[model samples]
Target: MSLRFSLMGPVRAWRDEEEVGLGPRQQRAVLAALLLNNGIRLSNEQLIGMVWDEPTPSALMALRTYVYKIRKTLPELHLKSMDGGYTVRAEIVDDCRGEPLEGLRSAYFDAQRVRLGDYRLKVREDCLERELDVLELQKHVAAHPLRERPRALLMRALYLEGRQGEALDHFHRARALLNEELGLEPGPELREVHARILNGDLSAPRRPEQLLPDLVDFTGRAEEIAQALRTLPGTVGITGMRGSGKTALATRIGHLVKGRFPDGQIFVRGRDVAGELLRAVGVENPVGDRAALWREKARGKRFLVVVDDVQDAATVRDLATPGSAMILTSVRRMDELPGVTWLKTAGLAEREARDFFRKVLGPARVDAEPEQAGVLLERLSRLPGPIRVIGGRLSSRPHWTIGMVLQQMEREGKLAGVIPSDCVAMLAPLIAAEERLSDPERHMLMCFARQDAEVIDSQRAADLSGADPGEIEMVLESLAGVHLIEPLVLGRYRLPRFVRFYFRLRTPALTG
Candidate 1:
């Protein structure tokens, strides 16, 4: 028996050079999540959280069915049934960086220069300042001997810690040194940051991308967020659809409890996941056993690795050394990651989504036309990604009212609206899902497109598609795995409203 598993792109498997039949999209998500962390056992609760974005009454039963289907399809795969969860057998080929529950690849890294802001984060404190860090900032200034950004940062750090006299004194010294050296004034941004510090705006916000944004009106996921904090020093997986605030939640938790991780907080994105972590901890150009070297270096260091926009779980698993805590955010469900807690982010509740709108548009703006606003939220699918994009557009234009926006939504239709209700953005994921389907599965989905009902069972599907009942059952299951169709209890299939609209929009000629 030969078996190959890919966690990259969409979760798929090959046995004997032929693609093995997989279950529904959620099930595929489960499979992908499992394959990524091949040796780790995931409990039923963990699997349920990663697979389903929302709480389902039948999640436990559904998980059982999905596992059984996977076993039946890939009998050669070593899918183990643990005491409380499940595990799958597959070798982790380290290469590629697709998001969670996708594909795998080995990590290669390159060195980078650490900025003052980044360095400062490694040794930051809230109420007090570390004297050695102050000296290190000074040492960087001495090395530059002419730059003002580092000097300005040093001043700000001192000022926040109630060293007003020393901060001003340092600023004056930096100003004099600059005049004597390059005959230049500090850059506008540096000057502004210094000014803000001088004005006692210590509580002023930093860049939105600076570690974590201040989520003052942070709306949902109280339980999951809390559990994530509690499970620190261990791995916590945050998986959701794109723009579901997976990264935001991870950043927030990283910042809130950073006191526990005194070593530092490493926020990684772009190339070289392992390389980036090594740089943060003072290692350069590792030549062997990257995992072992990383474990040695990170030993006794309480750094928090917040891996945003994760493309593959192999990167996370490889980076999860015996040392250090990790939090992974992905747009796909992740499974089989050993010793990792799972948190699946869904669309906000009605109340939270509405409240989020109020905060974004201001209470007066949304409250004035509450009914229309409520309807508008539903149209946006209550996903944070859409809400923030559209809300940001509206907030920037004060003259435009919520009612005006709603009218525009009706006129252009939610999916057709360019900025706020972008059909292309909403359809991208569905398109990707469709691309992963087999020829028969694609044909079956085409048949689904021709139907009127939003749901169809295996028997009804065969009737409408003119395919054999047994064949249709397998086809529907395949389509459901990529989320083109939803698999229900007793072999029923349901489609989301947006999905229904998209199918109807597809020309019959194209489907035929």
Candidate 2:
């Protein structure tokens, strides 16, 4: 009997005018395996092994189900079970010429449609991260030579994964093998994939800087940070003193390698926590609406987000993309966030300090001679903010040279305030603010803001706040929202220098 089959889009089997149905996955697997092999008697074990790829006690029963389905549909065809093997005894002939192997082919190919979509949508990502462990099993099964469709599907997935090199390599190898062994080129669909990879285009958007961070003038420290970032394998935390250039360095580091992120950078100030709290309570816009802004910035593509004066670890984690790079700045230590790379920014070394002073001071001297540069450098920590402020002051009053400015600074005691606006009046405002605290919460803010080091200890802070540890936790969290303080590590807090100073110097009248 010449059996007729139509196997495009959906698989259909027929003999003369009668139709046959293959009902279930295992049944389809059995029939398709037999069709692929053709005329061969497959032992029960071989059929079960091919169909399920694993041990099953009901394997024979499942095979019986497939055989029964096929038998019921093609009652005229003879199927014999003998010698513990199954054989299709039907004499299927050519349609006077080219026979129809189309039905079984369609069934087998249709099985792959959803699998291909799942591999593309549910598994692939451009972050070079293995996010879906469940797909790992699929990857192994799809790599086999006999599974051309699945293999091609997997390759297309990898191509969309931003691993252009690996994807292209697999595609080429598959193409070569398909042509050499099967005498067939990859279908037009896969051919289009080859074209796309060659053109460096894939459905998954590329992350421009996965391998390295963009380097900037940071010199030794910046390069060291970048190298640490590449090797460290996770997020980085940056800490420094006021005018120590933490924000500047963090911003520079992010900018240097912004292209690497491809996701753009996020900048949020530490002091904006109040705004964040107010927004959270629906009282006012979150400080600069940074949380909402961050969400917006992070909406579509990946990003390298920097939260300056990072007081909120929860906020940081919320804003962070799982595999993306982020640089956070704090006046305090942030040891709480996991997988954070911490880089400390101290004031410049003496030589760099001298250069900074001179950069602002210039070649010619005003009142004091050029040699008096050393005197000014020793008095100042060589911090850029202070150097610029002092230089700008002296340079403005051309009548005074370095010596005279130093002399007047020494006499008037205005040298401290002479620091740039960004880093002016450090300790006094903090101390006076401590005096004005009516509640332990306010005092806690004062203590955290005046942290001598770059980070604060929150648990110890609870002890200092004189509130229950839980209350301290709540207040600390609240202060963090207002950007008054930031978490350097769990239970520790760091205060921004400018705010600390502002509190100490400005009396209630000035502050109110």
Candidate 3:
């Protein structure tokens, strides 16, 4: 004889069309627990934990009694004890016609009721998807305004019915309700639906391939590239002063490893990193509670996300995924971000910078004026940004010699004019970094810059700034943390030449 069990309503069982007596409520709870894990073993402790909120000293004996009663009542259940646990072989039915475990009072049973209730609603949603029952979905959303799946289904139904405006309005209301109630915005699913209705794009979300074009004149960083590639499917944080070619190095690595991640390769450069990442992976206009949806999209996928010009650790935490890799470029080291392989970039080596100029200006042009080129490279501090700008200017004006270019740069008293129009934003990162400093920090930096020495120790810093030597050391360490200054042997520090120049130009009074 077969047994039919129902927990969707009051716990009951029928054996071959005859209703079986299931004894007391606690006994019924044991029977329900067994039925839930029909083919699995349930230890005495496991059974008690699932059936009672607080088990008494006699609960173990009580549980054993319940098992005996259940076996005697339903002989066909084949309940047997083995391996210090009980296992039952019985068929369980999911009948969702009524409330699950109705009339049950134990806390354990109440939690199961909620879980099964959610399962029932999910089944109903599966049915409604085929039926397109807008009214039913609306009621579900009204009752559980926080449930994103039901609301998304409603949005889709409304869009299919040509009620675009209504769908949009419903989304706005859902957003407002979620924000007001839970202090969260809607997740990716709802936002995607809203974007689709607004753009009339009912197609599947697009997988973004937004990596910026790799530098054609990309040069050097062979070791850095190898190190980054070795850390595949993990995070690599590249930190340096502004215009140190951090972005270029990260971009080069991104392109080199693009073939490994079949899911996609995404690039994020602006303030809206989370939203940009979501949209790149097909969640358009990702709103409230984006982290969960972003993780969902990233799970079980091999992708590459290159976040450029990051200012903080929190910006890329959600971008980390189990099966993907990330390359983050920032002006400051993100020490707070966990599990990152850090590489600090600096001005290119003389050999690499010369090779870069050769690639941009042609070997003949660079070779024709090797001496002048060396001098120009020295004057520019061999930083790739300025070198590239000068290379472009000379490339465009072939009549201009490296000597003439150097004279022009000298006459201008700054390389600001030689910088191409497009590359002018290079200073923005430095300015922003400077603006983030505290008054004390800025004042200390200016005082250090005003000193005549090329390198300063804590004593020099304290004497110049009139602060304690210990306190000045801490400030120097803080400055080094942001890559504004470089720490050397014997407690000495040297600010980068370009950074010194920048501070001198910005604060003329600090200059000699």
Which candidate comes out best when scored by lDDT? 3
Off by over 4 Å in 1: 1-210, 396-407, 410-490, 498-512
Candidate with top TM-score is 3
How displaced is residue 160 in candidate 2, in Å?
Answer: 24
**What is each predicted model's overall lDDT from 0 to 1?**
0.64, 0.54, 0.77
Alpha-carbon shift of residue 399 in model 3 (angstroms): 3.5
> What lDDT tens digits, residue by residue, belong to model 2 across residues 1-512?
22434322234556434566657655666765565345589898877766665547987887888888877866654567779888763322112111222333333344544443343332233221322222552554354564454444555667665666776777777788888988887777567777877876555422233223332333335454554344221467776555566666766666555644444444556656434422332334344556566455344344565667776666665455443456777755667787677777654676676656656666556224645776665545444555566777777777776777666554433222233342344333233434434465566644543453346566787666556888777777766643446566677766654444443333232324
lDDT of 3 by residue, 393-487 (tens): 78889898999977764554343323334434434555667878876677777665545245768787788778888888888888888877788
Deviating ranges (above 4 Å) for candidate 3: 1-202, 408-433, 439-452, 507-512
Q: What CA root-mean-square deviation does each model show from the true structure?
A: 19.9, 21.8, 16.8
Where does candidate 3 have its weakest 10-residue lDDT segment?
414-423
Tens digits of per-residue lDDT, candidate 1, 81-165, equal: 9798888766332122233343221121001112323332322322112232566677666766666666766777667667778
- As for TM-score, the candidate ahead, 1 or 3, is 3
Worst lDDT window (10 residues) for model 1? 104-113
